[model samples]
Target: MKAIVCHELNGPAALRLEDIPEPSPAAGQVRLRVRACGVNFADSLITRGQYQVQPEPPFSPGFEVAGDVLELGEGVTEFAVGDRVIALTLHGGYAEQAVVNVNRCVAIPPAMPYQHGAAFPVVFGTSHIALWHRARLQAGETLVVHGASGGVGLTAVAIGKQLGATVIATASSPEKLDIARQHGADHLINTSHDDIRLRIKELTEERGADVIYDPVGGELFNASLRAIAFEGRILVIGFAGGTVPQIPANHLLVKNVDVIGLNWPAYAERHPTVMTESFRILLDWYLAGAIQPYVSEIYPLEEAVDALHQVVSRKSTGKVVITVGD
Candidate 1:
């Protein structure tokens, strides 16, 4: 099997494409002939040893994958060989083959392509669980999505619209804002020029946004603290903007605000039911054509480092996928 292996904890530039031994599935796990892998900003973090769960050196950095079940491990009865499926692995997705726990695997909808299946889980799952389950976003509320043109951000915009909220999208450029608009954002805020806090207030008629979905956590998060409506919930998705904001308890006290931090992957381990239910709803929406992944770029497995760099540099919109085989 060919895999992109990271021999050091430096960055994506240090990754090497090499031939690796094929892995077999353990009990309760299934071996997959990986067709595609999703490239995430976290993939870059894991390479730098900055992610929450860091495997040792000499490992792969991919997290989600879609492929065929080549062999099923002992005790796995829900899936069979040749079944099309998507699996969430901690690592090793940037390879021709990956072994995944059956519990983390889901059947890919017949209509969904392998690239979409690979791209679906992380971004869509994160936004759906964050807005629907965690924030309890209401239908008539005003929702604001920061970094709205990026992977998870775009999904947040789409999901917010599907949930009936008026979504205000913020991005660094007009082109990015345009992409967000096409994805269903009701209002656009160009972070390059507009004042986010003022814009939200203006868009909401001084009431401020009822829910703020924040993925870029530096200055934008500070703006969210000011723009959120009273009793509003702010979902902290990530710090993609390169700076982690320090929250002031005074702001929360004054506005009765709730700053909720969401680690979407935690649901897979601590609350499997939540993840399963979220995926079920997302896949249903996909099959119904209500929501679809906007895969911006697809790179071959040999250029896995370049794929990771595209995401790490924040140069690509929506999802970037790495194809393992034809």
Candidate 2:
């Protein structure tokens, strides 16, 4: 089997394609003949040994994939061989085969393509769970999303609208803002030049956002602190902007702002029922055309380095995937 191996921690350039032994499933797990894999910002960090969960050197870096079950492990009765599925592989998904726990896998909607199923689990799971469960976003409230054209950001925009909030999307460029608008964002903020605080103030008639969805941190996170409404909830998803802000507690106190952080992957094991139900809702939304995935680029498995580079360079929007096998 072919896999992208990282033997040293040197960022995306360290990823290399090589022939590796195929893995077998353990108890409660299943082996997948990987068809497509989603490349995330964490892939860049993982290859460089900067992510929170660091596997030993000479490992593959990937999280989510769409594939067919090649074999079921002992005691795995819910799935069978040849079942098409989307799975959450904590790592080793950028390859021809990967072994994932049965609980981490979800049956893809019949109408969804392999590429989308690969992209679905991470981004959709993050935003849907954050907005619906964590933040408790309500209808008619103003919802603001940062990095609103990128993978998780775009999903947040779409889900905010679906949950009945007036969505304000902030992106670095007009083209990105346009893409966010197409995904149901009611207002667009070009943060490349516009003042994020000023724009939110203008859009919300000076009250500020009711629920702030922030995946890009650093200065943007700081701006969100100023732009959030009184008693508003701000969902901190990630620090994609290269810097993690040291928030001032006094500001949060003054506005009665609630800062909530959601690490979606943790729920897979800690609360598997909630994770499964979240995917079920997303699948139902996909089947009804209520939500759509935007896959901007699909690279072959061997080009995993280039795929991660595209995400690190901020050159692609929505999700970028790596095609593995048929």
- Index of the highest-lDDT prediction: 1
lDDT digits (tens) for residues 1-326 of candidate 1? 89999999999999999999999999999999999999999999999999999899999989999999999899999998999999999899999999999999999988999999999999999999999999999899999999899999999999999999999999999999999999999999999989889999999999999999999999999999999999999999999999999999999999999999999999999999999999999988998999999999999999999998888788999999999978
Model 2: CA > 4 A from native: none
| lDDT of model 1 at position 15 | 95
Clashes of each: 0, 0
> TM-score, each model?
0.99, 0.98
Please identify model 1 stretches exceeding 4 Å from their true place.
none
- Local distance difference test, each candidate: 0.95, 0.92
- For model 1 the TM-score comes to 0.99
Error of 1 at 133 (Å): 0.6
Clashing pairs in 1: none
Pull out the clashing pairs in model 2: none
Q: Which candidate number has the best TM-score? A: 1
